[model samples]
Target: MTTADVRTVLTDGDLTVVGQIVHASNATLVCDAQVGDTVVRCVYKPVRGERPLWDFPEGTLAGREVASYLISEALGWDVVPLTVLRDGPYGPGMVQRWIDTVDPAESAAERLDLVDLCPAGSVAQGWLPVLRARDLDGDQVVLVHADDPRLQRMAVLDVVLNNADRKGGHVLEGLDGNVYGVDHGICLHQHDKLRTVLWGWSGEPVDPVLLADLDKLLRRFDGGFAEELHEHITGAEVRALQRRIGALLEHPVMPHPRGDRRIPWPAF
Candidate 1:
């Protein structure tokens, strides 16, 4: 289906819970939402199912997820999938289009190499080593990935949104060759809470394309983005988002991990 059709189905569809994601910390369900004649598979997170966070308030993760989508859309980056906050079988929560992921073993095998096996410059052509560690056998190994442009864009998105839970699993590569970010529940806070697993571009120059997108976002907020955002998040959080954009605009480079705990645990 076309993207517009998907958006319509996601925004104004008959949501039906098909199953539950048992591993999720919150109440997450798999749903088949009907829009006109089409049914779109969606991941639904209900507020009533939310587990309270120490830093963030209770039952507010759902709104944060939707707010992340709005900010992503405003930046003109398809970082997050089509998402919305609506009443469902359990209660009000965030519902997003589910992306079918490319097998990680397949995707990683093509881009990664064993540090001990590959020649010095053999893997450096377009691949960047991201992880160096010991495998289960206690052998030194390194993991590399293609310098994918989409992953770079997603890194920028995470920075702008102040995403706090950008786990490796959150970065999904679809069969259609598009990379999407999901599960942005504790984001856009008024503090410097940008924890993520996408620091491969750390210390590199920010591409002009990404800078331009940030500029566009600034203009949009100056126009009406802040006003619209207030519906989903607090006024303070909206200001925090603007502050993040301004910081990125001034830096114009990929940020390095600050302090000792900038990145998330279990980087994979």
Candidate 2:
């Protein structure tokens, strides 16, 4: 189905819970969104199931997830999958199209993972090293991610959204050959809270094409896109997002980590 059709199903179709994503911190349910004959797999995070967060306001994660999708769409980058805010079986929440990732068993030869670990000092030619540490056996290993353009775009989106919890597991290698980011509940805060694992491009010059996209996004913000974002995030948060875009436009360089907590805990 086309993107529009899939979105319609997610918005209006009946959601039947199939199972729970037990690993998720919040209540994340796997469901089938069915509209007559068409059915699509989706993830439903009902607002009622949200866990309280000390930094972020209560029950606002769903909206932030949707807002992240909006920002990604405005940039014309498909870094995020189709996500929508709607009433579901439990309550109003965020629903998103589930991405089927490239199976490692099937694609091992190609090494499809965007983030990975390797023996210290043995980082692959095309991969960028992020951190070095000891493994369970006390042997040195390094954290690394691929130097791919798609992942770079995601890093840019993370900056714009001020994503606070971009763990390595949140990055998915979709079977369709696209890189996608997910679990954006703690994003778009009024204050700076950009935590991500896609910092491989840090301190590098921003791609000219992505800078152009940021320019377009700034124009949209002036054209009432900020108001639309206000429906999900706060007015101050919207303004903060604009400032982030403006700062990037002015500097046109990928940001370096600011503090010790730049990378989220449990990096995987």
Candidate 3:
């Protein structure tokens, strides 16, 4: 289906709960959204199920999910999947199209996980090491990720979103051969809360093409994109988003980690 078709089904279709993503921090329901003959699998996060966060306002995570999708679209990156805010079985919530990922067990040799673990000194030829630690059996292992351009784009998107919890599990290797990021409930905060596992490109020059995309996004913000974003995030947050883009345009380089706690807990 086209992006528009998927958006229409997510926004206007009837949702029926199929199961629950039990591992999620919040109540996450897997559902099938159907409109006529079209049925799309989606994950729904109702507002009532959100856990309170000390930094973010209550009942706003759903909006922030949609807001992040908007930002990704504005960047022309498609880093985020199609997501919408709508009424569901549990109430108004975030609905995101479910991604089908390549099965690691079935395609181990062909799978390209954005983040992974390797022996302490065995980082792969195309992977970059983030840190070293002991595994469950007390064996040394290194946390690493591929040095691929797709992941680099996601890293840039995380920077722009101020994504505070980009755990490795949130980065998916879609069966369709695209890298997608998920679980963005803690993003777009007014303050700098960037936290992610994709720091391999830190201090590297930003690709010129991506800088052009940021330039385009800034122009869209001036053309009323900020107002559109204000519906989901705070006005101050929107301004902060603009400021972040402006800073990137001025510096044109990927940022290095600032102080400790830059990477999220439970990195995978």
Q: Tell me which of candidates 1 and 3 scores higher on lDDT.
A: 3
The residue pairs that clash in candidate 3, if any, are none
Predictions in order: lDDT: 0.81, 0.92, 0.92
The weakest ten consecutive residues by lDDT in model 1 span 112-121
- lDDT tens per residue, model 1, 1-268: 8888988888789998899988677888999999778999999998999998889988889988999898888778888998999888887889999898756576656454211223333456666665565667776755454478888899888888888887776777777778889889989888888887677788998889889988888888878888888988899999888888888889888898787776666554
Off by over 4 Å in 2: 109-112
Ranking by lDDT: 3, 2, 1
Query: For model 3, how does the per-residue alpha-carbon lDDT over 106-216 read when each residue is reduced to its tens digit?
Result: 876855477988888878799998878899999999888999999999999999999999999999878898889999999999998999899889899999999999999
Tell me the tens digit of each residue's lDDT in model 2 across 135-157: 88999998888899999999999
Model 2, poorest ten-residue lDDT window?
104-113
Q: What's the distance in Å from true for residue 200, model 3?
A: 0.4
Candidate 3 vs. true structure, TM-score: 0.97
